[model samples]
Target: MKIKLALIVILFGLLTTQAQDKITVAVGTNSTFIETYNKNSWSGNFTLNKAYRLGPTSLKTLKDGVKTSLKWIELNNSYYKTFQKEVCRFKTMEKESFKFHGYVDEFAEEMTMIFYGESDGSFKIEIKPYNSYSIFITFTNLDMLRGFKDLLDGKSANNEIDDIFKK
Candidate 1:
C-alpha cells in the first residue's frame, strides 16, 4: 500500500508539471484585425500558445466573427527569440525595416511578417503573403508583447494558485 501510494504521488507530480509547461497569453481585450483583400474582420481576443504537442507554436484568433477560433502561421521555436529581439531593436529605430520569413508546412504556405513602428510609438505586424491576403495587427498594449515573450520562454501566467498555496 505504501509503495502504491508513493508511485501515485510521483505520477501526479509529473502530470502537474507537464500541464504547467504549456503557456498561453492573450493579446488584449477584443483585439482583432482585418484581412486586407477580403476586408473580413472579427472582434475577439487574440491569443498565442505553445502547447505540449510536437511542431511549432501559433497565433490564434476568432474565426468568421464568431466564438470559434483558428490558429495562424505556425512558426518554429527558434524564430521566437529572434522575433522578440527584432521587436526591441525596431522599437529603438536601430533597424529601418523589421521582417521575418518562414515556411509553414502544416499550411504549405510561406509567411512573411513585417514590423513597423507606428507614429504613436506602438508597433504593427503586417503579414504579407505572396499568394494570400495581407493581415495587419496593431499592438496597443506593450504588456501583451511582454506576456508573449514570457510565454515563449516557458513561463506561465497562471501562477496565482501556486503563490496562494505557497503563502
Candidate 2:
C-alpha cells in the first residue's frame, strides 16, 4: 500500500509538470491582428528596432501593409512571439508604470517577439527571426494597439480566431 501511494504521487507530479511544459500559443487571436491592422496602419510615433536574441535558425518575410516585414521566424528549435503579442505585453508593462524591460522567453521559436516600452507608454515592435535577422515595422497603429490590449485582457474580439488556440 505504501509503495502504491508513492507511485501515485509521483505520477501526479509528473503530469502537472508536463502540463506546464506545453507552451500555449494564442494563435486564435490572428483575426484581431487583421481587424486592427485593416482599420489603420502602425503609427510613426514609434520607431522599430531589433533586439539581439537567440533561438530560431530562420526567419520568414511577410507583409505589414506595403512594407515587407519578418512575419515568422523559423524555430530551428523554438517559436518566437508574433508582432502583436510583443505590443500587448509592452503596453501592460507601461500601464503598470514600469520602464521598458525584456524577459527571456525560451519557449519562443527561433524568432522571438520583442517589446520596447517608452516613457509615454508606447513600445516598438521587433520581429526577430530565427538566427540574427529581424523585420521591423513602422509601429502598431491605434486599432492594432487596442486589439492587442484587448488580447492581453483575455478578450480575443473575434471568437473564431480564439477557438483555434483551444485544445
Candidate 3:
C-alpha cells in the first residue's frame, strides 16, 4: 500500500508540474515599488522613435473629401537618442531614471527589449512632452510576452531561473 501511495504521489507531482504552462522572468524591485504588472490593465497604441522618446498623441481630420494625418509629436535627436532606431531615420530620445520595471517583445520587428528603473517605490513615469514614441506597452502585457520568450528559450526549465519567477 505504501508503494502504491508513493507512486500515486509522484504521478500527481508530475501532472501538476506539467500543468504549469507559464514562463516568467524576474524584474527586481525594492520594497517601495510594488510590481505594477501585478495590477492594472494597460491598453493603448504607441510608437518609439530612434531616440526612445514618447511620441505625441495624433488625430485625424477630414473634410471636403480630403484627409490628413495630423502628427502632434516631432522626433528629435538632441534630447532623445539613447533608444536606437530599427528603420526610419527619425529617432526618439528619453530617459530611464529608474521609473519603470518590465520588458516587451516587438515580435513584429523581430526583437525583444526590457525596461527597468530603480525601485524607488514611486510609480512615476518620467516622460517628457512631445518626444518620439517607441514600443508602447503595458507592464502586464510586457511581462507575459517575456514569459513566452523564456518558455521558448527554455529559461523556465533551468533551475537557475526559477528564482526569478517567484511572486
C-alpha positional error of residue 7 in candidate 3 after TM-score superposition, expressed in Å: 32
What tens digits encode model 1's per-residue C-alpha lDDT throughout 18-45? 1121222222122111211111127433
Better of 1 and 2 by lDDT: 2
TM-score of each: 0.32, 0.24, 0.17
Measured over all alpha carbons after superposition, the RMSD of each candidate to the real structure, in angstroms, is 18.1, 20.5, 21.4
Give per-residue lDDT, candidate 2, residue 148. 38
The residue-level lDDT of candidate 2 at 25 comes to 14
Per-model C-alpha lDDT, please? 0.25, 0.27, 0.21
Best by TM-score: 1
**What is the C-alpha local distance difference test score of candidate 2?**
0.27
- Predicted candidate 1: what Cα RMSD to the true structure? 18.1
Considering lDDT, where higher is better, how would the candidates rank from best to worst? Answer: 2, 1, 3
lDDT of 2 by residue, 28-113 (tens): 11110111111112552322122222111111112221121222222211343333343111111111111123323332333344
lDDT of 1 at 59: 29
- Identify the superior model by TM-score, candidate 1 or candidate 2: 1
Mark the regions of model 2 whose C-alpha exceeds 4 Å error after superposition: 1-109, 119-121, 136-143, 149-167
Error of 1 at 51 (Å): 11
* lDDT score for residue 31 of model 1: 18
Can you write out model 3's per-residue Cα lDDT over 47-146, one digit (the tens) per residue?
2221221111110001100110001001221233233221112212221322242122221122122222223321111112223343322222323333
Residue 109 lDDT in candidate 2: 36
